[model samples]
Structure formats: C-alpha cells, structure tokens
Target chain A: MPGTADEGFYELRLYVAGQTPKSVAAFANLKRICEEHLEGRYQIEIIDLLERPQLAKGDEIIAIPTLVRRLPEPIKKIIGDLSNTEKVLVGLQLKPHH
Target chain B: MQEKDDIQQEITSSMRNYSDIDPAPLEKAPTGIDGFDDITRGGLPRGRPTLVCGSAGCGKTLFGMEFLARGAAEFDEPGVFVAFEETPDELIRNAASVGFDLAALSAQGKLAIEHIYLERSEIEETGEYDLEALFIRLGYAVDQVGAKRIVLDTLEALFAALPNEFILRAELRRLFRWLKQRGLTAVITGERGAGTLTRHGLEEYVSDCVILLDVRMAEQVATRRLRIVKYRGSSHGSNEYPFLIDRGFTVLPITSVGLEHEASDERISTGIAQLDAMLEGKGLYRGSSVLLSGTAGSGKSSIAAHFAQASCARGERCLYFAFEESQQQILRNMRSIGVDLAACLEGGLLAFHNARPTQLGLEMHLALMYKTIRTFRPRMVIVDPISNFMSLGTQIEVRAMFTRLVDYLKTEGITAVFTSLTSGSAIDNLERTETEISSIIDAWLLLRDIETDGERNRAMYILKSRGMAHSNQIREFVLSERGIDLIEVYTGPEGVLTGSARLAREAQTREAQLDRTAQLELTRVRLEHKRHAIEAQVAALHAELAAEAAAFDTALKAEQGRDARFSEDRDRMATQRKKGPFAARQGKGE
Candidate 1:
C-alpha cells in the first residue's frame, strides 16, 4: 500500500526481472531515497516482471532493473542498476536540483 | 533444449539476412582512442559488454586499460577495473612504461582497480550457488566510485574456476546481462587458443561486441592488428586495422574511404623569391602538401628548412621532424645556411622532433607523429627525408603509413612539406623510393646533381604542380655562405650544366664567350666613332663655302647699283666717281 501523491508529486514503479543482486540493490537504493527525500508524498509499485511476463509489456521492460514512473503527468523510464544514485535521481525527476 | 535450438535457428537465419541489411542503430560510447572510433563508427555500443580477445602478449590488457583510461581522461567518466590475472600494482606498473598514469587517475577518484584473487583448486562447488557475492562486490565498487566504464581482465580465469562448461556458459551469460543491466560499458578480455576465438568459446555467445587483437610476424617483422569480429547492432569496419602500443595505445584505421572536403587555396612562400616566382606567382598553396625528392647532399633539407623558416617568420608554428639528424646536428646544419632553428625554438615558433626510423615500427612511428601533431597543433610540419622510414618497414608498409599521414594532414588543413631521398644516377627509378606519393602531392620538386665533364653542379626543377604553372627550366643551385642560391643555367655543348662537371664546363664556356664578345663589341664601337668624326669635318667645310658665296653675291649687287647711279651722274661730271668708290669700299668691307 502507498499514499497518494500531491498534485505535482510523482508515482514511481520499479520493475525488476528477478531477485538478482542488481535488483536488490536498485530496490534498496530507491527505498532509501524515497524515505530521505520524497517521504510520504510518493507511491512506489515494485513489480517482479519475471513472475508475470505479461506485465513486462505493460511497462515496456526490455531489460532487468528498470524503473518506470507511472503516476507522474508524463511517464519516465530509466534502465540500469541503481549504483549511480545521482544519475538515477536525475533520471527519475526525484531531485529538485541536480 | 528446444528453445536453444530455436535460438540457434533464429541466429543462422539472421546471419543470412544480416549480410545484406543495414545493422540496427547502436548507442555508442566514445572510446577516445585515436582513429579507433572512426573504424567502429563512433564507439562500442554503450552499456553493452564488449569482449576483447587476443593471443598471449598481443596487448589485450593494454587495450583494456587504455579503454578505461580514455574513458576517464576524455569523457570524464569514472571506470572500474577487475583483474584476475595481474595485481593492481603490476597492472599499474606495466601501464606506466607506456605513459599511462593509472595510479594518478585512480587517486583522482576517476578509476578504481580491484584485484580478484581466485584459487581454482580451493573452490568447491556444491549445489547451484548464485554468483551474488561477486556481483555485490562489483556493484559496491562501481557505486563507491560512480563508474561508467568497467574492465574484467581475462574472463577465462572465471571459467577455469568452474569445472562445468554448462555452468560456465550460464554464468558468463548472467555476467554479461548483469553488466548491461548496470548500464556499464564493460570490456572483458579473454585469452585466445588454437582454432578458437576464446578459451571456452563463451565470448562469442556472451558478448554484444567482439574485438580481436592479433600479433603475427610477417617477413620477420612483427605487426599488431585489431579487428571487430562482430558488433551486435552496429556496422563496424571489417578490415584488420593496424595499431601500436608505444607512448600510448593508438589505433590506425587503414581502410577508410571518401575524402570530399575541399582543400585550402592560399599559397605559402618557400622563402625563395625566385623559386616562389617560378611557382606561378608565389609558392605552395596554404594547407597543401609539398614533396621534395632528391639524392643525398642535394639540399633537400635546405629546401624543407626554407619552407619552415618562411612559416615561422610569418608568426606561424612549424614542426620539423628530422629522422636522420639529432636536434643539435639539425640546429648546427640549419645555422650554416642562415636558418636559425635554435632562435625559432627559443621563441617557441619552431619545434624539432628527431627520432631514428629504425627505433620503432612503422605504426609506432606514425602513432608518435600523430600524437606530436595533435599536441603541438602546428600550422606547418616538415619530415626531413621520409625515405629513411624504408629501413624500418617494407615498401608497402612505408607507403601505407605515408598515405595515412598525408590524409591526416590534409584533413587537419595543415600545410606539410616532406623530403624524400632519391637515387643520384636514375631519374626514372626515383619514383620507386617514394612509390605513388607524387600523385597525391600538390607540388613535387626534383633536385639532382647533374654530372658532366668533371663538374658536379646541383640543379632543381619542378616536376609537377597541381593547380598552377611552374618553371620548366632547370635552375642551377649553389650552396654558399649565404644559403642555397638558384643561379642561371649555362647551356654548353654537353648539356645543361650540373654538379662539378657542369660547373667547370660552365665556367670555361662562360670565360670563352665573354672574351670573344668583348673583342668584337670593342672593334665595332671604335670604327663607328671614327666614321662620325670624318662626317662632322666635311659638313663644317661645306657650310663655310656656302656662307662665302652668299656674301660675294650681295656685294656684287650693291656695286652694280652704285655703278648705275654713278653712270647716270656722269653727265654731272666726275661726282659719280665718289659714289662708285664708296660702293667699291662697301663691297670690299662685305
């Protein structure tokens, strides 16, 4: 369950293929950032695309460890491991100044 | 198994159609190696693992490190290096010899080199254990440094640790997937074995891009080449491109086509007014290549230096690459002709790069030149006697290097002047040394020492000029205290004078002709002067006689008038006698 965002806040859905190291790291990194920055203002839907291959097309999952922001006015997607926090934050539109 | 079979069938069918169809567009990350991106058409596909496979000591590690170094240096992208074969120190030390400052780059937080120690005998595998530990380490390293590029040196070691080939294959596939998922441009190096591109045949399956490095001895000369065997979504150069690992790793893309850029039209003076006048109005067009071909001691270097001095005098930068002479020797030799190269050096207008052609291979020499040119950014470059490069490589190799060098110079819009040594005895055979360089050269000047009688007189002639008219006559050249001077040609019975034989014959013939012309002109002038004197005396005598005759006629008229008057007055007695006497006195006075 997730809280509803403000009129301008974003809703992010991080779709991972499996419980690989990169996936776990991406989940951890996203959760930590949400708690630190967007706290109580955003919704995160974590979908394991491997279990449901049909969802892969819904989010257009070409590779694993993909972050799809669904609830924003315009949808944004980023594909990579969540190692580079700054780039991820910038790509996700989660940071005000980058 | 069925899925595997289907995938194989799909691959085969794709291969059949792939040869004809254009490859899919690739998102490439620039490697920053010289001339490498041009061959790969930008660079390797970004975030896709590229496998770098080569035989032992074929510069696989060097290539990998260079890729990472370039990423850090050029793109400002941080990189991580995971080594299973060499320690971090060993890798750093090995790279330092080639001027790759890895440690300093690492210290600057741009690179992180990690050594993965794995003992094959100690690792015992039980059930299916995910390589999550290794992945976590790699992920943590990348995160700590925010790396965009990575290198896994010698992937074979990982396969060796795992006995089962099936497990190895699966693991390698997972590894590649992991790297791609991380969006890292990774270079995984592998050792090549007999009849295989890699040790486990896993590189072909796991890599999205495959680059093969080869070192082979052809005709007792070892040459290194790199070829892209497959790039999944990009069209890469198919030919084997030669490379060198000297001061830095440089890749020479030999097989590129299509040069449609227009060359510059401005002319640069060669510092010789007569020679400049001979070349149409001035000298070579700015950004045009000039070739000076001659035998030994034919003043080829002098001609090149004159061009350099001209460029330097105009406040333009010039680079003089002398392969035969040392810097000191070049300075001294140029000073003899009043070209103070040392002063130019002190003023930072002229740079001298001297190296022995035999000190390195042809590719190495070209790489050095490329690096120097890039760093110096000179407006003019002179290679004093490029023929010396023949001692280091075969004729074909030398020609290829020259072609690339010329092409590069043209592209950069740098005016280049190169001197080549030709044979003294044969004019037709001189082309053999330079091969087909004359075709690409904008201007070709041939210097020869024409031997006749007992004199060896130096002479220079313009063999060809692409867009302008040049002097057709052979100009005699002499080296004196001032400098190399072009003198007028003295045609004798033998032929145009050249060398000592021509000089001596010219001197003798000039003296004889001077003596004969002086005597003949002197005699003609003396006879003309004598004839003018006699004609003046006769004219003066004739004028005097005419004046006297006129006076006598006037006097007779006056006397007749007086006599008539006196006769009329005779009737009046002897009064007319006085008038007649006065008329006679007047006639006598006249």
Candidate 2:
C-alpha cells in the first residue's frame, strides 16, 4: 500500500532472513492490521536479509521477521511473527493506551 | 598445524589407503601470546568455539579482542569481532588503549568489527523468532574479511535482549555449528554467572575449549589471572597463569616453565674480587640464582650495586629492581661505597625500577618484571632487598613469586642476584629463607653482624654453593670509600678475632717483641762494660807494679851509692830509699 495525500502516512519496513513461515505470517498480519486501521495512509517495505544481507547491519536487526516503523517522529521496532495483533499495535505506537 | 598439513599431503597421496596414515592429532591455532602457546602446547582447537568466561572487568573482552588482534596482525589470519556489549567505535577506542590499532587493521581488510545492539526496552517480541539477523550479520562480517578467527564478545547480552531462552539456546547451538561448518576458530566471551562458568552457561555449549579469567584484589592490590579450565583435545598448563593486559595479553605461565634451561658452567663476577674469591674463585654461575642475605645497613645494596656496575662494565645489561629505596637514594648510597650507578645508567646498560612492593600485587610485580626483562633483555638482574616484598603478601606467596622469577630468569639464562634483609641471628634468617627459597637459589651468601669487644662488624660467609668450591672462612667485610674490603678473620690463641680484637692482639704481640729486644740489648752493653772495667784495672795494676819496680831499682841504686858513701858518710841517701825493701818485696810477691 502507498501513502495517500489527505491523511497521516505510515511507512514501515519488515526485515526478514528468508521466506520462512514467520516472515509470511508477519507480512500478512501487518497488512491486515494496516487495512483495518489506516489502509490508505500506510506503506510497507519488505527487506529480505538473504537478498540484501548488508541491510541488516544498517537497521540493527537480530531477530528474524522484525518490523521497523520508519515514517514517524520516532522509529520503533517490533520483533517476532506478529501473531498477537494487539501487542504489535502497542509496540508500533498505534494503540498508545495499551 | 604442520602435522595437519603433512596429514593432508599424506591423504592426497595415499588415495584411500586405510593403513597408510596414523590417527591425526587435533590441530590448533596458536594465540601468539607469550607463555600462552607454550602452556597450551598448541592453542585453541581449530574450527571450534572456545568459551572465555569471567566476571565483569576480569578481561574476558580484552582477551577476545587481543586474540583477534594478534591473529590479524601476527598470524596473517583475518578475524571478525562480533561485539554485543560495546559499539564498534567503543571497541576501537578500547583496543587503542592497549596499543592495538583496530581501525588500521580494519582498513587493511584483515579485521572486521560488527556491533550488535540489543535492548529489551527498544523492541517487542510477540511470537517465535530466531537470531537469524545475528547469524547473517556475523556471516557477512566474516565474508567481508575472509576471517579465519572470530570473537563473539560477551554473546550473553542476547539473554537480556530477547525474552525466550529456548530460541536463544537453539540459535546459539545453531550458531556454533554454523561457525564450525565454516571452519572458523572462534572465541566467545560470557559473563560469569552465579556459581556457573558463564551467565548463560555458554561453557556447556562450547565444550571443546574453555578458559576462565579471574581478577583478585588482595590488600588493595589487584592481579589478573588466567586459567584453562579445560581444553578438550589438548594438554595445557593447569596452574593459574598470572597475566597482564598491558599493551597486550601477556600470560606468564612461569611455574610451567620447568627446569628445562641449560646450566652454564661459566661464572660471572659478583663485582667484589675478594667476595668472588670467597665464592668458588669467581662469582655466581652465569645463569644461576644467588641469594645475598644480610641484616639492615649490612651493605646488601652496595654489593648489588657493585654487581650492576660490573655487569655494565662487561657490556651486559643489568636490570635493578629496588623495593625499599628510591633510585636517587640508591645511586647516592652506592656512590658512597665507590659504586657509581649513575655512570651505568648513563651507559644505558643498567635500568632501575624502584617501587614499593605494596604498590602492586605479587603477581603484578612478577608480570612487570617479566615484561621489563623481555623488553630490556638484561643478562643480569638484581632484586635489592627482596624481603621487603614479604609485607606485600604472605610468606608463601612471596616465595612463589621468587620461585617463578628464578625459573624465568634461569630459563632465559639471566643471572639473578637477590638481596634479602634479615633480622635476629643470621642463622635463623638463613634457616627460614633457606627452606623457603634455597630450592630456587643456586648460591647463598649470608652477611652477618659480628658483635665483638663492644662493636658490631660485618662478616660474610658462604652458606652454600651448589656446584663450586667456596671458602668457608668468615671474612669481616668493611665498606670503605674504596669499596668492600674482605679482611681475613684471625683464629689465633685468642680465638676468632675480627676488626678491633684482631688489631688489639696484633698491637700486644708487637709491644712484647719490643720489650724482649730492649732487655737483650741492655744485658750485652752491661757485659761489655764489665769486661772493659776489668781490662782497665789490670792495666792499672800493671802500671803500679812497674812504677814500684822502677822506684825499687832507683832506691836500691841510691842505697848502694849511699852504702858506698856511708862507708864514707853513713848512708844518708839510704834514708831517702826507705821504701826500697817494701817496693822490692811487693814487686817480687806480685
């Protein structure tokens, strides 16, 4: 999804080693959450460390399937498969109260 | 490594012949640290992970860093440093403190440093994950430098960053396997856990080789020690090797040096000629250890200074370690004894390290000495008043330090002169230190204060000399401006005499000889005088008899004439010759 003109935009980067189950599930879970919350204003970039292994050092990546929120005042990171959507939202500052 | 290469060649030539080659020994990668490779026999098991665990600030990271640095610099092997605790810049700065130029090594493409930043506060873990990013980073770092050695410094930080131990453990196992698969020698450092070798029990995972570093602070003196808890495939030094992280990792496995050094029969001077005569007609053996035991103010320093100056005169470097006095004080005092150490210092053959023994732990002192010896390459070393080190540690520890020191010096073929201050009787001091340190000492010279006739004089004798004939006579040594003068003690009828007692006996003997000579001369003069007096009396008697005979002759002639006249004038002249008959009788009777 690309950012829209009329609203606040959300740019996210998902870093993964390869197409593991966790990577696929994290991409799917992240897309689903953005669609329900800010479908038109959110954009996601997928970086496979297997293809661009050098990119891992720049983003300080350790755990596979790590989602880094890029477009925002403060860059935030949420690791794992994003199986618990509520915790993922809390980690990305999407739901501040939680 | 050579064996591995030979085996590789053998395998290629044998072409699957089963009985052609023997079972190959485990190959090792040498760490290039002094005494380290010697103790390990080889080094860390090649292509395996070696766990180096220790408490905080005990030099685990430094050990790992130096391993990589030395590999990259000396072994021509590229290394990767995976830093989990500090950033690459921080690592560079830390390495710089020890004189390692990490940035230069990195720029030369011989080393790579990867900083892995993990904070539990900055990220959230919602589901299962592995440390694939770490693996990828390490792999990339390794590939970037074609590394043969890698250091995962404090890899236990992942336990704090990630919440799941199961995944971390599984990933760590995979990582070690991955490292082995790549055929890279690795050193993984971990923090010491509560009663465990490592915080995350890393030793359990990396079982091939495990090293433990320890830092102990005793009496405000800290010493860093290293020990190989277990090397799975290699025999290593089992003792705790005292190491110094100055400039680099210097592991002095002094105890394990063994008695492998060759004994040279060549003797070197003790600088005092008479003392040399007292000690085997020369001085100490070239590489043997000599113990000079004495009481305070007993010229130990003077003798040691003489040795240092003598060494310099022979164009050999001599390192002097002064524990009780400053360099200036030693130089000044030695000058008073006609030993000018300043000239030796100016000649650049004599180096002095004057410090209080309490300034550092016993092991640190040994390390410093070892370092100085290695750098200075002194052929002779003098430790002035080694007993001052007794206040630094226990007697046993001090003895241990000296034992190692003696072994190290002997192995290097350096002659060592150690001066120890003793109190009470010289015998007591010798007995105590002889048992404690004589095993290390090749010669012992006991300097004692002989109290006789209300004065204390310094006397020296050889207590023991292992391989040479030494004089057993106690020499009363005096320290004058002309230097040490060894005077032979007198053992006359007045018993053993030294200093003023011998002088007094000599004076008394000389006075008795003078009295006897005067009496003999007086008796000869009296006898001569008596003989002369008797000769004079006989002459007088002879004169008297002659005079009397002449008078008698004259009187008789007058009497004859008077009788002739008396025939005419009645012998008037015969009255004048009244003494004639008395004279004639006297003459005839005589």
Candidate 3:
C-alpha cells in the first residue's frame, strides 16, 4: 500500500535508460539521501524506460535521468544526473524543511 | 563505394547490437519552464539529440545554451557543453551576459564545458579515424561528475573537418546513437545553408527533432524567426514565429496565435487635439498600429513628432526610426512644431535610430530594429517614412518585411506609428509599396496637400480606424511655429483645397458669393420691411377716413332732421298762427 500523506512519507521513481555513468551516479546519490533521511518510510521505484519504451508515456517522459515523485498529491519531476542532491531533493518535494 | 558500404554495414550492425541491449527509461526531467515542455511534447525526447539550425546570428547557439543552463541551474541536472566554435572562457563570458552562471554551475561539479578546437587546414584524416576521440572525451567529461544535458555548439565545423561526406554522415549517425545510448538529452546547433535546411544535410535526418531559425529582411527591416521543421513522434508549432534575443539570452516568440491573453484597452492621447478629434475622441488605443500616409511636406513628420512627444510626455519610452533625415535635422525641424525632441532625448525617454534606407539589407535593418526594441523596451515606436525601404528592395520584399514588422509589433502589444509617403494627388490611394502594407494596419490617417486656385492647403482625414468611430470630414491643418493645428473642414468649394493659390482663389470666390448673397438678401429684406410699414400706415389712414365719413353722415342727417323739424314748426306756426306761438313754445320747452 502507498504511504499516507499524514505519515510524512514519500514514494520516488528515478527513471534511467541504462547503466550510463550519469545514471549510475543518480542512483547512488538518491540511495544515499533516502537512506540518510527517508529511512524505511519511503519506497524508491526504479523504472528502466529504455527496456520498455512504452512505459515512458506512463509518466510522460522525454529525457533520461529524471526523478518522479509519485506518492505526493502534486507529482513533482526533476531531470538530469542527480549530482546535486540538494536540488534533486527540493525538486522532488522531499526537502526536510517541508 | 565498396569500402563505404562496408563501413555503413559495420555501423548499422553496431547500432543494432547497442539497441538490442537498450537500457531502462530514466526519471522524467522537468525543465521547470512553462509552455516549453508542451512544445517539445514532453521535454526533448529523453536522452535524444535535438538539432537547432539557423543562419548566423539567428539565436541557434543561444537556444542550446539556454537549455543547458536551465537544466543545470533549474533542474540541478549537470550539463556538458562541447563547443566547436567559441572557447570555454568566451562561452562562459557570453553566457554570463545572458544571466547564465556557467562558472558557478561548473564549480558545483554539476556542469562541464569543453572547447574542441579543430582546424580544417591542419587536420589529416586517416582511414582508421573515427569520432572515437570525441566520444572518449565526451564520455570522460560526462562520467567525471556526471552530466545529464550535453550541448554541441555546432556540428558543422566537425563535419567540415572530416573531408569525406560518407564518413561524416556515418559518424553523425553514430554520435546521435551514442548520445541516446548514454542517456543524455543533447542540444546540437547547426548552420543553415542557402538552399538546404542545414549546412550538413545529415543533421536533419539523424536528429529526433529539428528547429530552424531564419534571419531575414522584409522591406529594410530584419526579423529573426523560429520554426519547428520536424519533431519526430510529437506535435509542435509549425508556423515561423518572430523572436527577439534580449537580456538573459531570452528568446521571445512573437506571433504565437491562439493564446487567449487579454490586451489592455487604455487609450493614449496623440497630443494634437484636432488629430485626437479626428481619431474619434482623444487619441489612439494603446497597442494599436497607426499608418500615417501623406505626400511630401504634408506634415507627416510633424504629426509623427507630435505622437512621439505625447508618448514621451506621458513618461512612456519612445523609439523613433528615421530613415530619411539625420537625428539632428529631425530635432531641428521638429522644434518648429513646438516639439523639443532634444529634451526628450536628453531625458532618456526617447531614442532616435537614424540610418539610410540602403545602409543595410532589409533583414539587417529589421534585426537592428529588433535589437533596439529589445534593448529599449519602448512603449511607443515611430518609423518616419517607412516607404523609404522600398528603395532598397522590390515591392514584394518590402511588403513581406512590413508584414513581419507589423505582426511583431502587434504581438508585443506596443503602440506603433509609421509614416508612408504617397503622391500628393493620390491622397487616399496608397503608394505601390504602402498599398501592400495597408491591410495589416489597425488605423490609417491620410494627409493631403490640397492645391486649389494656386493655394496649397494641408488637410488630414482618417480613412479607416478599426474598432473606433472616427471623424469622416477632412480637417484643415496648418503648420505654424507653435505646432500643427487642425481646424474645421473648409466647405468653400466642391474641389479639395490643396495648394495656397487654389485655397485663396476658392476663399475669394466663396467670400465674393457670400457677400453678394448677403447684400442682395439685405436689400430685399429691407425693402420688404418698408413695404410692410407703408401698408400698415395706409390701413390706418383708410380706417380714419371711414370713421370721419360716418360722423359726417350722422351730422348731415341730424341737420336735415332739425331743418325738417324747423320747417314743420314754421308751417305749424303759420297754420296755427293763433296756436303757433304756444306749439313753438312747447317744442322749445321740450
């Protein structure tokens, strides 16, 4: 079951095309942040759009290295290799300030 | 040909193997800009190369840089910029002018910029040479800190280095495939050719999307336009839209139809009361395009100056594009109309860009106008004698240029007033060049020099005004030391009063006829009034005579009756001599 909004939880989907260096970095950066902050309260869904090209439309994908926050009421998206964890976390609406 | 075929076979087989092991789709990259993703049909086909092609100075490189900068700053998606033209330092400096903090992004370990220097003269192409070195460098940069967005400032220079067309084509195809395989959304810039869409024809075929930029001159005006030539698997705006590159490397797409944005309905005074009256009430609507047409010395410049003065007085900035006169000359001439353009210039509310009509091609002129407008951001623009551009090109070119300029002005929602010189005799009729521009204008004012009886008289009339009720009568205009004054319409003659001689003759003839009619009518009325007085006197005299006659008749009848009575009394006295004294005495007593 998806986490409730009252629980202060998040469900993030990080889309990657392949094992490119940028994709691998994005995965690593996201895992590090989620483990440090989200702990067991979040679920990270890794979607490989290249393997199933049709799935790109499910979230209306155009570019790779994009992060989609699915559990939030207002879905948020961030594109690029997730080198800047602060920008990615803020873009995905996972900021601790909130 | 056999060797080329073998190379092509090898490339195709390698692409197949690469695709067969296709990676998973990554997260959606949001550019965080409004309406841009919609045009791309979902941000630029994720990790695919999109080619933006245009002629020189058409904002192709700017568009790519903006995309990369936005990705790095807004999305935190580090970007790799590989420039085949400008150096990294120059690129960073130029981008800084547009408000792109490239250095900061690079220092943050999210962005990498590399300048690839290639000399066509020094390069030696070996048969075994592939773009492997470029791929390696790009890969190393992308991997060093990881870049999600890659921008190749130009692909044409790289293509130019490799002397063989077959090799260039194959290498480009492989480059695109590799970018996709690496999951990088790339922006590639290409130079436009005169006949073909791109300098390297292979760019159009290899990219998932294609955007073409055009810098053209219509009349003598330069305009930069952008069009989506092809967007594979996505719908996009197909029309050529005018754009301006301003601060922040911003590309403002003008002429985007179907956007339901409401324009302001405020009216700005033209400052000339008579001209304002001619416009219906007071002045022109804000954001309206006004076309003022007149022959030589018809006070067209004076009227345009008045508009500019009015706009400046209202604290709104005005841009005056003068093609025929020097800025100093214009200022001196406008002083006669009480317009202190020098003051406006000094105050920084007005700018005058004066140039010869033939100084540049129509496109360059338009580009200059676009650049100036972007820099100044004026609320009002005046192009005195726009018809002069006709001397620079054919009528068709002028017409096309005017169409684009008007469309751009309308899209900007700016008040634009342009003067066109028509022949004196052809007041309502437009000149050949201006005839083509008349349809796109919102309002048209025709000024004519009416020559009647050797007198030249100036008159202005509003031929047409969309969405307003304007005066239909031709108002008399006078250019004096104070300014242009519009007087009541001259109704002296059937013919239009144009020249001073004709106007004077018509005035003389009209005054003569008016005096003659006034004298005749005065004489006739005076005579009629005398006749009426005489008639009234005669009627009174006749009434008095009739009353006198009645009184006289009454007197005569009374005297006869008295005489009869006296005779009767005498006869009675005689008959009654003995009783006559008594009867007479009784009658006297009675």
| Model 1: residue A30 alpha-carbon error in angstroms | 38
Q: Model 1 interface RMSD, in angstroms?
A: 15.5
Q: Ranking by TM-score, best first?
A: 2, 1, 3
Best-performing candidate as measured by lDDT: 2
Per-residue lDDT over B1-590 for candidate 2, one digit per residue giving the tens place of the 0 to 100 score: 66335533532333333222224577999888766887899778888889888889998888888889899999998999999889989999999998899999999999999988887888888897888988898999999999999999878888898888898899988998899899999999989876567767676577677788889899888988998876765788888888998888899877836789999989888889998888767888899988888888877888788889889999999999988889999889888888889999999999998888888888899888988899999999999878877777777887888888999899999999999888856567656677678778998888888788998888888888999888999888899988899999877886778789878887887888999999999998998999899999999999999999999999999999966765553243344347465554444333
Q: Compared with the true structure, what per-residue lDDT tens digits does model 3 show for residues B1-590?
A: 66335534533543444343324443345543333454544567667777787778888777777788888888878889888889889988988887788899889887888777665543322222234345656776787668888988887887665566775677677888899899898888878664555666645344356677778775556767667765555666666655655554333333223324345578889979877877767689888889888888988999999999999999999999999999999999999778899999999999999988787776557756876886799999999889888777777767777777777776677899999988766544465734778887888998887765556778888988888888898888888889988877546556555446545666888899999999999999999999999999999899999999999999999999999998897777767767547676676555
Evaluated at residue B268, the lDDT of candidate 2 is 89
Worst 10 residues of 1 chain B by lDDT: B121-130
Query: Looking at model 2 chain A, which ten-residue stretch has the lowest summed lDDT?
Result: A1-10
Q: Model 1: which docking level applies?
A: incorrect
Error of 3 at B478 (Å): 1.2
Estimate, for each residue in B181-233, the C-alpha lDDT of model 1 and write its tens digit: 89999998888865566766655554367788989775455778898877777
lDDT comparison, 1 vs 3, better candidate: 1
Cα lDDT for residue B363, candidate 2: 89
lDDT of 2 at B412: 92
Q: Which lDDT values do the candidates have, in the order given? A: 0.76, 0.84, 0.73
